[model samples]
Target: MFDLSQFIFFVIGCLATFALVCLLFPHLFTRQKKFYPKRVITAFESRMFTRLKDAFPHHHILAQVAFSALITHDQIKMRNQFNRKVTDFVVLDREYNVVAIIELDDPSHIGKEQEDAERDAMLIAAGYTVIRYTQIPSIRQLQRDIR
Candidate 1:
């Protein structure tokens, strides 16, 4: 009951239908570009220190930590908290206003007490609770602060 001519037409029609479907929904065959979050790298001495910001406790123990522990959605983390920008590592409140600012400092920061005071003042003026930590804080200290 099968005719060769008819079989050829059916095959062509099926191929055409598939091609039409592909054209209508190109995503079926085309690859979409993947999205990636931007990582900010600074040129200061803390460039090395900043990279450690993303590291976890015992690296093997906690592979992934909560975003609330490190990241904010409103603004990107800035190297300087109070100078040119509004604040660094700013966390917003329920009202969507800045609530907290975290500053990371190197050992040299010990000599800049006046500068630190001024930066803290600026952050406080903008209603942000600023917490400055050493470039190499102990895991215990970081855990306590994060908590």
Candidate 2:
């Protein structure tokens, strides 16, 4: 028959070794810094965001937010695939449900028509109203469009 005492000692030795390694190399188990400087919003985006905030005082407006934050994906593959797409701005109701997404179209978006369209399609399919603006619209227009 096997020796039970020997098995217990071996298990203890393994546990002690793991603890010693963790203590000696604590950094290996710690998370590394992954954030760096990045603009939250461009000047135009800032101006439009301010207008949106004023127009919809009752709602919350988030700028330069990832699409994943606004919607849930049942499939892990789809979620990971689309997690990198960022929205220009998102308008949320009092309960924090996304009401709409606003994109400020600039010169840079000219060549990205297909990509933008795809993103818009995805957002729309997810039941969010998507609005694109070439220039900042008046508060009244925003109110009318959003409503």
The number of the candidate with the highest lDDT is 2
Candidate 1: tens digits of C-alpha lDDT, residues 24-141: 9987788887789854533442442343344332222211223244333345454334224332344344454544455666566778888788867755654556667666565566
Summarize candidate 2's per-residue lDDT along 79-117 as a digit string, tens digits.
Answer: 876789998998999999888899999889988999999
Clashing pairs in 1: none
Return the top candidate by TM-score: 2
Off by over 4 Å in 1: 1-39, 42-87, 93-96, 136-147
Q: Which residue runs of candidate 2 sit more than 4 Å off their true CA positions? A: 1-36
The C-alpha lDDT values of all candidates are: 0.53, 0.90
- For model 2, the run of ten residues with the poorest summed lDDT: 26-35
